[model samples]
Target: MSDLPIVGAALSLAQFIEMRDVMFGHDRDLELQDFHNPQTLDSDYTALVEQSKKALDGYGGRHGIHGPFWDLPLATWDPMIREVIHDRMFKALGVCEALGSTHMVVHSPYLEWDHRNIMHYPNAREGIFERFQTTMAPVVKRAEEVGTTLVLENIGDIDPHFRVELAASLGSSALQISVDTGHAHYAHGACGAPPVDYFIKAASDALQHVHLQDADGYADRHWALGEGTIRWQAVFRAIGQLTSNPRLIIEVYGDQSVERSMAFLQNTGLAQ
Candidate 1:
C-alpha cells in the first residue's frame, strides 16, 4: 500500500503466482531453491524462469532472488569447497538473468564461533574479512558482467562493522549489503553482537536489500511482522532515513499470514 516497492517472498513458482497481483503490481522476492532441486542439476531450471516471466509480465516493481547458500560456505578455507559455492552461485545468476532480477542475496560466512577461533591471532578480523572477499571475488565479477548487484546478507555475522567493512572493501559497484532483521535480532542476543538498530545504521550506506521478517530473541521464527518481539516502528524509521532505497521483502513461514502483516504495517503507519 505504501507503493514503496515492497515484495513478498515466494519460495516456488506456484507460490509466486498465488500472489500474482500482489507481486506483479508491487514486487517479488523469488527464492530459487523452491523451484530448482539442488541435489539434482540434470534438469534445467529454464522452465521455472519462463513461468516466472509469464507471471510477472508488465510488473512495475524490481525483482530479487535469494541464492542457495546452505552448506555452501563462500569463505571456507578449502579452495575446492569454495569452487562448489562459486559454481552454484553462477547457476543462480543464470536464473537471475533469465528472470531479469536486479539483485541476489548471498549469506555471509562469518559466524561468531569461527571468529572466536581466531581471536588470539594477530589481525584476526582482517584475515577473516580477506577470506570472505577472496572467495566472493569471482561471484562479484560475474555479477558485474551480468549487471546485477550481489547483496551480501548477514546471517552468522558476529559484528555488523565487519560486514559493512567487507562490502566497502569490495569497492565494486556490483556488491552491496543486505540486512536480515530477524538474524540481526537473533545475533544480538545469542552472539553478543550490537543491537539490531546499530546493525542497520552501520550498514546504511551500502544497504540495498533487506529480508524483513520478525523473530523472537531466542530463534529465527520468521514470524509475520508485529507477531514477534521486534519493534517494527523503530526498524521502519531507521530504514526510511537511509539515502538508498532498499528492497523490503516479507519473508515469513509457510503458514504465516502476509496479509495480516501488511495490514499491521499500514495500520501502524509504518508503511503507507
Candidate 2:
C-alpha cells in the first residue's frame, strides 16, 4: 500500500444509510451535503441533526459539511449584507458543533474578473481581502472555538494563490484552503487559469480539503473519475507532496459515482 489516505465522498443525509457500508469500510472523510442551502438552515434542522447523529452513530471517520454558498459570498462590502453572511455562517457552524464536524467548506469570493482587473484597479484586490477579513473575523473565531476548520474553496478563482494568500493573511488555524478539481479544470480550459495541480501546489500546507471530480476543462462537469479530461495522475502527484493530509472527497453528482471514482483511483494506483 502507498500509505496515502484513501479518497472519500460527499454524501447527502438521504444517501448515508445506503452508502454506510462503503463509507465505514474505508473510514472515509464525509462532507455532509444537507446543510448547504440557506432555507434548510432557516427552517428547523434540529430534526435533521438528530437524524444525522442517529445515522452516523458509530462512524469514526472525519466529518464535515458543505456550508451555505448560495448568495452568501464572504467578501460582501455592505455591513448589513455582511451581517447576513455572518449569520448564515454562524448557523452553519452551529450545525458543525452539533454534529461534531471538524471542517466546513466555504466558497472563495474571488472572481475571474478581479484577476484581469487587478492591475487596472490596484486596490481592488486588497479591498476584497479586507471585506472577507471583516466578514469572517468572528466566524473564524467561532470556528476555532468549535474546533472546526473553515476551508475556503476555489469557485471562479482565476488566480490560484489568492485563497492561499487570504488564508495566510488571516493568520488563524481555523482558516485553510480547499480545491475543487472540476472548478479548477474549468478555469484552466475556459478562463486561462493554471491547471488543477498548480492550485494544489499553491495551497500546499494550507490545503485542508478537496472536491475531487473530473471535468472537460471547459465546464464544471463534476463527472465521475476517468470520465473527463482532468489529469488524475498529475493531480494525485501534487496531493502526494502535501503534508497537510487534506480530506479528499469525490464530489461527483450521482450516488454510485464515489464507488466508480474510488475504483478508478485504486486500479490506477493513485489512491487506495
Candidate 3:
C-alpha cells in the first residue's frame, strides 16, 4: 500500500491515552463532548479544560475539538435564542483558546426539511442566511481573534452548495466548510442528494476539516470503516484533489473500531 496522507482520530482524552499507539503522531479531534453540555460548561468547565491540557501533553499533531452543536442551531430568528447560541459558541471557543487548537467543528444549520421546502417559503433561504449571519457575527469575530477556524459540518444538509455559498457570503477567514462522510452518504442514499465525493468537491478550497465514518445511507451510523457501505475510495480520491489539506479524522466508536478503520484505509491505500 502507498503511504497515505497523515490521518487523525476523533476520540476523548481517555480514548486517546488507551489508543495512543494507533493515534499518536497523527492529527486528532479531542471529543470534549462536555463542552456541548450547558450544565458542564456552566459548572465544571475550567477543571475539564485543565484536565484535557494535562492529558494532551507531549502529543504533537494538528488538533481541534468538536465544538458545541446540540440544540445550538445557527439560524434561529428569535433574538433571545440567538443570544444563547452566541454564548455557547463563545464558550466553545474558550476551550479552543485554552487548548491551543486551530479549528472547531460546528454543525450546518441547513436541514433536510429546509432543502425540500425552501422554495415554497420564497424568503426562507435568505432569512436563514440573515439569521445565521446575525447569530454568528460576534462568534466568528472571536474565532478570528483566537486564530481558530470554525469548520461548518454537514448534518442533515442535502444541498452541497448551500454551505459553500453561505461561507462565501460571510467572507470571513474564520469560517470554512467541513464534511462528515457518513452524513453525506446518508443524504445521498436516503435522500436524493449527491454522493459523499460530491460534497468534498463542492466545498473545494473552502473545506477545512472532515469527520470520517461509514454509514448505510439510512442513518448516521458512525460505524468503523468497512463496516458500512460508503465509497471510501471515491471519497479519498476527491479529498486527494483538494489543495486545502483538510484534517482527515476517523470518528468511529471504539478503539478497536478506530484501529480497524485505520487498517482498512491502509490496506486499500486510501489513507493511513
Which candidate number has the best TM-score?
A: 2
Model 1 scores a C-alpha lDDT of 0.76
Ranking by lDDT: 2, 3, 1
Q: Arrange candidates by TM-score, highest first: which order?
A: 2, 3, 1
Quote the lDDT for 90 in model 2: 94
Write the residue-wise lDDT of candidate 3 on 221-243 in tens digits. 99999999998889989998989
**Candidate 2 — what's its lDDT?**
0.91
Q: Write the per-residue lDDT of candidate 2 for residues 112-166, one digit (tens) a residue.
A: 8878888898689889889889999999999999999999999999999988998
What is the Å distance of residue 202 in model 3 from its true position? 0.4
Residue 71 in candidate 1, Cα distance off native in Å: 1.1
Worst 10 residues of 1 by lDDT: 33-42
* TM-score for candidate 3: 0.95
Measured over all alpha carbons after superposition, the RMSD of each candidate to the real structure, in angstroms, is: 2.2, 1.0, 1.5
Give the Cα lDDT of each candidate. 0.76, 0.91, 0.85
Best by lDDT: 2
Instruction: Identify the superior model by lDDT, candidate 1 or candidate 3.
Output: 3
